[model samples]
Target: MATETLTYGNGTSLQASNLPLNGSSAGKPVDIAMDARRVFEVLKNGGLAIVPADIGYGLVAIDPKALERAFVTKQRQPHKRHAMIGSYALHKELHVLPEREANMVELLTRDIDLPLGVIAPLKMNHPIVQKLGSETLARSSVDGTLAMLVNGGKFQDELVRLTSEAGLPLMGSSANLTGKGTKSLVEDIEPEILAVADIVLDYGKRKFSEPRPSSTMIDFRNVEVLRFGACYDVIQDVLVRFYGITLPEDPGRGANFSGHLREAAKR
Candidate 1:
């Protein structure tokens, strides 16, 4: 099968061409109606695809059953589940979080421009979220003008509908291989990863000051910050506003941690 290639220039345009009609188109953008249909066919046939994340882009396997393949390709640990990227409207729909979690989502979506990540509970059982843990699912919005669906297009609702119907939460992560900095264009991705991918919807190079990593991981299960990244301050600020609780300066460990939060929740 012929490989599909896309060129992401400096935030100008994203163009996809030369994609095999029956191959995976997971992480790539599906702008045209035919492209979207063709990609679905390939995915139905067990093909793998890649997609762009808000910061960079990501690999998405066609077979929801084969989510592990995408993670392994990125050399990411199986336990670290990928975040789901969807539209603001869809986020409002699929979200079946508790009042506290729902309140947080409202706050984040209200301030949409700022990159926000929410560690909320999942309503249905999904392989991706289940693999990580049954407690919470992390979600964020993919913002890019060129790549609408992945980048917040009207089709974003379609993507979310498909995923929700399939009972699968997309495992969204940066396009570059694990531990590597976020890549700006298709050419910047590693060849090994690109080789297995079915299609690449290049949006050209992005013009961001620096590669903004995904938001920090705050596990409500543990009520702890797993990793510090882009949305640390914003998350803390939101939590305080909604819960009337102040997070510690250092989220590492001590008397104040998830344990304390859990205890307070019970009270």
Candidate 2:
């Protein structure tokens, strides 16, 4: 397979390999570190990039202008906030939650090996929280809380690690126009979203392409179901069987196309 240079709004061009990173029989081998580093550099320097995760592809940015561009490109609503690309370490340091709620997060991300979009109160004085300047903070947070993805996938984990080390918070949403549904494959991502990205990691199709488009987002404050997304069924079961908390049944995509219980949750 050949490598192609992908250029985007930030005027940065990256040589994206058409092959998968691991030496799978399907294609040639690419270096995950090298690719992640390049994407991190682009994002760190105020550029937008689309990267793959287990649940879906996402568009991430650190610059306020770039973040605004992403929102415009997606035509996302004003009320929707971008989720933070975060790790357990980052979550422990930045999110403020009760003991049981925090334990639930640990159980889901570490024990069950599930990905989650955790919405919780932010530790306002945390260094990483302070690092996200005012504009980024305003765009990424809703009220006093912020949503962060935990254990998304190998690629996202690496990216979060990089951002954490650099003291730069990465905030983004699923790489698709709002309401159009999350995209699981880089090739399936809309060209409009791709065009706004400075670099894109085309890591073939994501792992969880069925059941949902993105990670199941829960507001830890009250365990509200903001979005019934990927791995939702398993998450719902674990919460009930272990924590004895039952989440509302998914109405399926037919009734709730986006799977967002916004009205019921009042989010």
Index of the highest-lDDT prediction: 2
Q: After superposition, how far is residue 41 of candidate 2 from its true place, in Å?
A: 1.1
**Candidate 2 to truth, TM:** 0.88
Worst 10 residues of 1 by lDDT: 141-150
Q: Please, what are the lDDT tens digits per residue for candidate 1 over residues 1-267?
A: 444653432323223454332212444333434444444445445565555444445566435444556667778754455556555554555444566655555565455343444454443443534533323233222221101122233333454556555654544455657767556555677876777676665544443213244444454433454444444566678777767757555343243232223433455
Model 2 error, position 205 (Å): 0.8
Per-candidate Cα lDDT values, in order, are 0.48, 0.82
lDDT of 2: 0.82
What TM-scores do the predictions have? 0.61, 0.88
Model 1 RMSD vs true structure: 9.3
Question: What is the alpha-carbon RMSD of candidate 2 to the true structure?
Answer: 5.0
Residue 41 in model 1: lDDT = 49
Best by TM-score: 2
The true-versus-predicted C-alpha distance at residue 98 of model 2, in Å, is 1.3
lDDT digits (tens) for residues 1-267 of candidate 2: 132333322323344445334323324444566667878888888889888789988998887788899999999888777788888888898999999999999999999989999999999888888888887788788889999998898878888889889888888899998888899867677878877887777766689878787989999999988888898999999999999999999988877878888744554
